[model samples]
Target: MTTVNRSARGRKSLAALVCGALAAGGLAAAGVTTSLAPGAANASSHREAPLISGQPQYDNTDVYAFVSPDKPDTTTIVANWLPFEEPAGGPNFYRFAKDARYDIHIDSDGDAQGDLLYRWTFKDHVRNGDTFLHNTGPVTSLDDPDLNITQTYDIELLRLRNQHVISTTKIADDVPVAPSNVGKASMPDYAKLREQAIRQLPDGSTAFAGQADDPFFLDLRVFDLLYGGDLSEVGRDTLKGYNVNTIALQVPSDHIRQSVGQPVIGIWSTTHRRNASGHWTQVSRLGMPLVNEVVVPLNAKDRFNASSPWNDADFLPFVTKPELPKLIEAIYKIDAPQEPRNDLVSVFLTGVKDLNQPPNVRPAEALRLNTAIPPASEPKRLGVLDGDNAGFPNGRRLTDDVIDISLQVVEGELLGQKNDLGDAVNANDQPFGDAFPYVALPASGSNGPLAQGQGGGNRSQLEGGSAELTASAGDNGTLVTTSLVAAGAGIVLVGLGLAWWRMRRRDGAVL
Candidate 1:
């Protein structure tokens, strides 16, 4: 390992130590775990990396996959933009990248190479002038509602098989843009406004561009402290009152699928921007294997993002390199009880079951969904743990409780039909709309407390306006202690061994 790599690993070790201590101290007792595990090195989604926390604009907030609830033969792919945007910050609102190239790549052949790509770009209308505030100011009425600050964008459907580009018709002139939610009258009915954004494609596919609810929900304060050293708890609470900006795309499954026989597909998103030197640069990439790059290790994160499924062969060595649990083991100073657990290599890098798969195509980290298997209309939030494979790793849905799913799987739920975790995997409220713009919650008010209403059970509401970002005492602060310290210690020792092996390799010493 390079000196920089070593240093990064060392820092990760120290972080793990602090986090372990905190977890043991019960600091995360009040925290809520959403779809993603907050503190563990085994995070399953993007933006979990320490570096990207400062860059929310490029954060891969959340990934959703489900057969279109309205159209059974089509799939709705919705990728959220801008994590945790405060609804009150207005005047200058958030918008999707205008110059940046946004793409949703799909791989249906099972090889991981994208067989089809949907590309998008936008054009802003900041120059247009219509200076009359409706329901206020001098005049009571304006001649046109369309002459406001609007934007126009185009979509391109690329067929990778033939390298063909199909462009859609331009959205002509100007259209009324949605305003920030300041009051009932100021904000248009969000549902109606979103419907207006949908543009019909020549091929029968439909696309909509506008701000929607953020599907991801986590008690960030709890998780951050957990990683810093608090494990008094082992589960998560649902986020019932938050929202995010989203770009939704729906298309006929056959339009993007490479083969009718296999319905499985790989999906990913990328954001790019032109630098001062006039060169386009990648801001971030979020795909099938979600945060594989972010949580892998600092030294390996960038390399993971720069490579793709097609070129994975050239990057397999780096992809299979392990550093997480090893670093944890080193920091905790404990010897692993098992052989493969000694290093993160065997579990995180090499597949425990299907070992012959391609490098980037490793099932160890990617969200693997067999599309041929029809989705369960009313999927159990616990997913495979509940004998339902329709959620997560199988392709995540908005309501799937991924945090619990990941925790259960890591505890050996995949080993057989029997799950020992029991209620640990069964305790969560999963509710989402069954149509386009699937995330149905409204944008939370800035000063309102985090509300905890059950989708079908015990309901709690935090009313009035209070600028607190935590759940009520009744729902929060529930802690459960476990033998995580011993487990953490075991993983750290494995890291030390791996480090020693690398040192020997550099010194030309025989094992």
Candidate 2:
């Protein structure tokens, strides 16, 4: 009894500290800025943490949940992994880690603990290991014999109450995974392959697992001395050509909600990889975008990944008093929101009341969505900030401009200080699909120049072998294509960078 009381008191104190940090100030308190300050931002959890960055196959890069637009009665949850995958990366193309358990968790009763979970376990196969090619010929279908490598997955649905598993059911099995978009020659009709991969489960839900263009767009050059040292290099989409392994599920709205009375639900995704001792250890976790990237400090990053939201109290200090805004204040010389930022708490931990917050909500990091809300007729990229409640902070959508919205909110936009802070990059490089599995098609390998050494080029050759790398014509004068790997080798050429890379590589699991 005393312990419960003490815990309650501690929570109240923390809430008070956060709520009182930002006094209700008007436009006057927020100094007028003639020109909006350029903000520093990165891809939503793409290579965000130290440990997960090294294990891309098990990295939960981004998660999106929104009421399906076409099928308004259903909701879609899209989670991505293996960030920064080169489209032409063959010889050993990327696939979901067979030894990892990729899971999507849902909290229906606002307990900060998942009441339901969908688990995916993969099995990789090689039809012809004798050859080095991903595919021997044009891959017209998912089961084409020419495809040397393939993967199939099974899905299990687990129902939990108070963190104790009540039941576990196998929802899907032997679902073919959509192969990577190797190129035109290998996968001449990739769309048909993706369509074939989509499966209708025993439950009234749709599932798809495959490669897709990374939907989250932002200038990663912010790490380049905060954008070329003066914020000048901001508009280029750093992840333009990259792809990610995606797991997209669309389920009936009523399936995930606690009850008709309780419409809001929290969603997050995690990746657990089997260690050497045959123990499944969680290595990556993601809920809200940028929480791991900008909010959590460097020291507790790995710990945060292994933690569940029910125990988020240990991470309260990071959310209450974040470090990104302080760095923004220091570098850009712009006043940041006051300490113990309750506004952020409202956004990240607890859902905004009268908006997406569930009943008796517990403060934790998860993407809260009001299942009752319908899709917007014309979705606004700024989301709720732009008066579109059907978007982010209400369960993110594919087209939500989270970078600009996060920047503005971090700069005190919600606290009545209207600011237009942004990173200049507006939208994704590729267009998203209009239906289920809304992410864009993965970029093809035949689109650009081959990687440095792959194209018969070397530093020893004069003029960097530009002559050998020229475009060629195939049979009947048809243009032959190759992919360009924009390998930024300059960063590794520096002495300090080399040391940092070696240290980070040694710190995490190499595979």
Candidate 3:
């Protein structure tokens, strides 16, 4: 069937699962579960590593982990930054944080301790010019051109082997840079410009720093409304018409891991800055767990973002905790006729392991992969859920259908049992490159509203109609039109009552 239909089918199956679960318990007679997850009740509505939530511009949105298809023993790590950078935001242009320190940590042993670290930092150069054209403008002679706002960054590689400090390199204009999204003729071979930014390390490892298309696709509006809002339609409504800033690094397997037998590694990224107090503050942190805090629970989300592999002991209990099933039970207001059945804890949680066999670590939130598992040259988008063990939770790639996979696993699809929910997942286009500097989405004109290109065209034809939702801006800047607050005074009253109730509870009164 078509990709759009497939995705729709997946959503219907998930909704069915919720309905079936509620029906079985007679909970459908009460109410639907629509309350927002406590963790999503923060200012920076998007997920970012804990410390970096304060800095929305540079908050690391997602970290991707995958084994390089071309090379064995090599891992590809991608960290995305500056969510929703409008192409029209001109003049100063987007740049990596200068004072911010970025890093990736690796752990060879399953205990989750870093055995190697890769770090990067940036320096800014502000030169004066006649007209400060941020992204696009007319080109002219540079005999005495102003050089205001030029920047360079440096990278460092540290090996825990013998506690040794290994390689260092500086990246500047000498390195190839991706051209801004002007016209193809004006920015002819922009991809080629991006290629220049890839540098070879002293250890022969490859690293790239530049902009690329955002790989994340989700119907975020549906999710926002799904959690305690008036709007109630659900189908995939992801950002099909936008892009994001990206910094990606690829390293040789041996360079990152010792000859030691274990193939597992602990990974995390950080952005740092010196506050007015002069102490360096870590703005963000992310590793193999992959948006665990954001998807898991609120009380644990911040701690998940702030802690490291070495200090995971402080947060492991929260990471491994099975709260969803309990939350589901509570929200559905179902009391067990006999004893409670926390199905989530029994099956999914207990099944996750660090290694393939004996002495396996209990299931946890981190994405665990066995390097010994050869990479699949031709990856199927269905991923591990399709019984193809090489995809997601094994180290996610952009093409993996995580939503469906998560749904299936949560609905007992992995236990060789048929879920009344049917197939709970689907994927969109399964196209991606197979080499270093993977292909990115093509640029579009920012002079008007962003368009979805061919993807939208195909979707429109398949739906046999056109989508009415469009983009709009509120006091908080650009937001989707569907995100506009619902009209009516009833919602206002409920909101005020909630506020007072919260205040009363904070004052230690029983509600």
Candidate 4:
């Protein structure tokens, strides 16, 4: 049966730090655990937003941008959705919404707003419905007839200025999402099918969508650590057996870069759903994993998701006097940075000064990357903090240990305070695959390594297929549909987009 670790140190200045109950102030002082977030192990943004918590498939989980290790001339930007997936998710498997719009925004010139938008829309197909199983027989390939649940998506890459679409082009179309890894017996050659899912776009870009091993690793026992627990107990990776839906893109380095002289670019992902007006509206978004989960107060989490980087300055109070640091000080007794943490503001809000920062840009939040910085030869997990400028906060690499790095920063290491902080679980359960879509293959639902004493059949693998996430979004049970899309995601966006394309073609306009 398929399943997954269920399982750090320090002391510091509480006197100078704000230690009282800080709910009114939106501060998550550690001792105040009532509404404080315990944080996921990977520093992931799973179900972090309030309204977004109500929508998982569209809930942006994590965003990673890096210079592709093998292809240094291209950059890989991966956006994940749906989380905590069990391998044995049968009956109805997890997937992207065929009608809803998913996006990856890049601020190339930086004023804290989008200069480029990569819009994704999916269309699914169901081959058979007589049986309760997703596959009638062993799945041999991505387009196999035995594969009942299949999906294809279109990527509309647009160049934007001042919040209006200036140029739009569908770079990729009909790209298939990889099939679920059911079991070895059912899918003997899973690697080949994964290869099939990785396709080349007309514009010399590469696209991949489907399940992959959850790349972020963290020792989640930090919940216990808040109460003074020993760091030794923090070695287990709680997210070990889970899988998530991923949309990975590899674009030529020059094409992805925005400004002329500046090599740095800011990136983030957002998901939009069709509302009553039949127009897609932003529902969820994420950049820094632990930001909304830790920094944004519980009340404003959803609003934060809906807002843009331009208006991020409105949330400055939360950043400068962050609640997460207060909690670390109150509970863990660690000395957090003093008010006005320019370091954090630089790292999270704006791009790091002179490194990834774009001049004249607003103080907006995004994961910035300096494309000129090549991938490190022997990468360091601690990233820039460890003298490896090629890793996270520069542009996240799969191997970067963001948890430990963030832990060190919040613990006042940036201020010259010393601490031997580490979660102990230094690596992913399975090392990353050395390929275009670097994420590991999706875990099989059947034949999980069922270690002793771990059994519970009630768990559903289609985790976000619930009223909160997909209530109006439409639900497709075991039944199959002839329509390219199944549920509440209206095709109005597709209709308008296609209409625009046809108009362009008819007018003989230069694309």
Candidate 5:
């Protein structure tokens, strides 16, 4: 805000630019952690708006659409909900919104409107209500006898023409959804349990719905310091140890596309919950991460999420005159680009030209994926900026470091401002699978590293518990499961008290 502050920001802006240019070019495999890595708040759409934040299950967390590596002929679309989930969540765990309709939209014609809509509606089922335990026995399978509380869902694929549903087909009905990774006792061999939930659809497609580690990672504390921390010394990735309910679909390229249509498709995820009038009301929408989290002002965030992309023109001023750069300059002394920021508009609204853009596509918010591009053998998490067209803004891959890419974008990466700007957390807590439904198994409840209280041993139980939830991804430590055992013991104690009271009442009556 002051001249002195602006002077410092100017220096930072130039320094970050130099660092970005070098990183953009060929750099060492163990390259220096770019100085700008911790320069901005790299965030996702989890609880980004006021209204949607209240509806965690209906709130869209992250949307990813990438070419399937195992089956190149197919495309994978994944949408996650119930963000920032604690693996140790108790008696009442997370589930899908039965009252809402979740959808993944594809615009093969590049009109920024869905040409084909894949919708999901869920049903909650309690196998038995007499017991407090979620699982009466070990969950050996998707339909395992031990699983007490469960849920089922049906998927519908609808083709839209002229904004009216032309045809609707039930893709899968009464499909099983895998239970949360409650703990070893409840869900032993989560990997095998996950397989049973991966059902093949009648339309030559596949579906998976259940819990998975929260894929979006970023530094939450950096926002406090105006994002000026060193790459190696910034905020910790708070997203670790969290879980989310996910709905993933793998379909042939032609399923959502006409054989003669465009290869590039615009993808986005949205959720609608029924109002008191019994009419569905759009509550949340997400494509690119942090669009509403940081870009939209507080008052307009809910409206932005509820409105359609066709009305995006109303919010263009925020993208063009972003407040992030001004905040950086005011707090940390860096000058943002002058107004008329075509870069922000293009990146958030329209796809980047010649790289990920659809031909003659109208500017709108959606993750654009070019189906013709083959998946990278060893993908670059940094995305197209790193010469890997198979990742992020080009359709998000599970391995992509969206936080880093987003931080770079925050500092005007598209406007030629390049820095290693990021939260320093480069990968997800879990490793992705090689097959369709590629998400890694969810973090277990009672055991594994992320469970509460017990410095639980290695995340070796699942794939992602690599280190302290707040520590670096490469840092390894043992996770203790003391809390789970304690929790089990506490349940037993409560049950014993009830039984003793019942006996006491009976004896008193006899006397």
Candidate 6:
């Protein structure tokens, strides 16, 4: 009887530790997570590695999968690339790298190896390269002659066994890609262009490739010493105005599932680039948010991106003994979870038992989803933690609040801590789409924050009736004073520089 009591207490204590560790880890790491806006929550996978961070075009920022809410018989996978796109960026706006292969891999049987692969390869075209303009005029349609820069992509489905390709089938070709949301001036009806890009594939699937507002929302300020070093700067959405290039596909459930009996499937996305030697190299890999960003050590971050799920054992140590929790403990004075964090292994690697886990599941880092589980009518941001089984960690939905859910779970919600730890960023800046290709429309370049000294159209004219330049009676005097101050500062700087040079010369230092 005493042994049983002690065992129960130990479990409870361990749960508390795990909860605290998770919260601390989240607060200390990349400090970003899922969105909580109505519809689907955006999951983060942005610039998690040094090598991939340098190559935005080939970076796989986020991957989302869920049973299509409208079409319950199918599953949709949305993968985003090129993080933090400035909407105002023009002429050379973002697009998928033509030289790279963007692939979505599925482990249908839970062997930690992908049994099916959906690959997208893009090709760019410029109707008139001589023009610096992205569009000659308003792009009435995707094929508008005014649209100078355009892109098309092909989709190929490959069946794999034992990591070797067994069969390849072309499902789509020459499909028009949804161009960037250049602005209201260029794309008069951007949503119409996006819808037009949504093609009905020969394989009875739906495909779209184009720019979308970055769905992931979180307070990235946690990196500033866990939020202004005192948690004051907590609620702002750091990615509110950014954009990402998205590739979405909604396919019949039966197409990718192993069998009706094994309904659970694991999904992940990777980007491979062709080197100068023409050898393809996997540069970015994403399955779950915050894995590469915080879980893996810096030295192994690049390696993790290039690795496959089947070989995830090499990274087991990081999950078992995460460094984030320890850092959190040191700073927050919270107890870190004990080593051998099997709870995390189950959540991050293998799917949780009886929820999304496959029978005899092999531990691996892939987002697992049970297609058999119908979509939730009214989804909760907290996901399964809130008893909403259809949400993230089941397979990410654009609306599942992964950041809060993950932080709460790590804070011990699963083990019964009942904590509500989160980054306080509840929803995305924009609402997600209700139908297929459910991400929010990309933010327009013309609609972003105004530049310094720029005035809005509605700004009242100055006293001189000129909004462009505000004239003042003291303008000449002000200019003279500013110039004198500048000249005085420059003279002072020059004098300091000459004195420093003389000192250096006296010390026989190099010039």
Residues 1-511 of candidate 2: C-alpha lDDT, one tens digit per residue: 0000001123333243223223212222475211111211235667675555445687788889999999999999999988777777766778898988999999999999999999999999899878888889999998889988999999999999888999999999999999988987789899999999999998999999999998888887777756776789788776777788999999998999999899999998988766544566666788888887777777777667777888888888987887777877888887888777899989988899988999899998899999999999999999999999999779899889888898889888888878887778788888998988889998877652233222332211113435433333443543222321122234445767778778988999373
What lDDT tens digits, residue by residue, belong to model 3 across residues 86-114? 44334454577665777766656544455
After superposing all C-alphas onto the true structure, candidate 6 shows an RMSD in angstroms of: 12.5
Highest lDDT against the true fold, candidate: 2
lDDT of 5 by residue, 240-342 (tens): 6667899999999877764434678888888776754455667678887667777788878766777776667778898889887777667656567778778
- Tens-digit per-residue lDDT, 1-511, candidate 1: 0000001123443354234334434433544212221123222232444444333444455556667656778888877655544443344445565667666677665565566677667676553444443212121112224324455557666666533444334322233323333333344344555556666666777676665555654333223433334343434432323345566677887866656765666676655544444555554456543235323456555445434544444434443343332333454343222322212222222322232122344332233445545678777877655766666556667766665454334333454423332223332233556666565534533321222232333333333443222332334643312333455667899999999999999999998
lDDT at position 270, candidate 3: 57
| Per-residue error (Å), model 4, residue 197 | 0.5
For model 6, give the 10-residue run with minimal summed lDDT. 1-10
- Which portions of model 2 miss their true places by more than 4 Å? 1-42, 448-511
Better of 3 and 6 by TM-score: 6
In the range 208-270, model 4's lDDT, one tens digit per residue, is 988888787876666564423545567777677777899999999899776448889988888
What is the alpha-carbon lDDT of model 6 when measured against the actual structure? 0.77
Better of 3 and 6 by lDDT: 6
C-alpha positional error of residue 318 in candidate 5 after TM-score superposition, expressed in Å: 1.3
Better of 3 and 4 by TM-score: 4
- TM-score per candidate: 0.64, 0.81, 0.66, 0.79, 0.80, 0.81
Better of 1 and 2 by lDDT: 2
- Clashes per candidate (backbone, < 3 Å): 22, 3, 19, 7, 15, 8
The candidate with the higher lDDT, 3 or 5, is: 5
**Candidate 3's TM-score:** 0.66
Error of 2 at 152 (Å): 0.3
Instruction: After the best TM-score superposition of candidate 1, give how far the Cα of residue 31 lies from its true spot, in angstroms.
Output: 30
Off by over 4 Å in 5: 1-43, 225-235, 258-261, 448-511
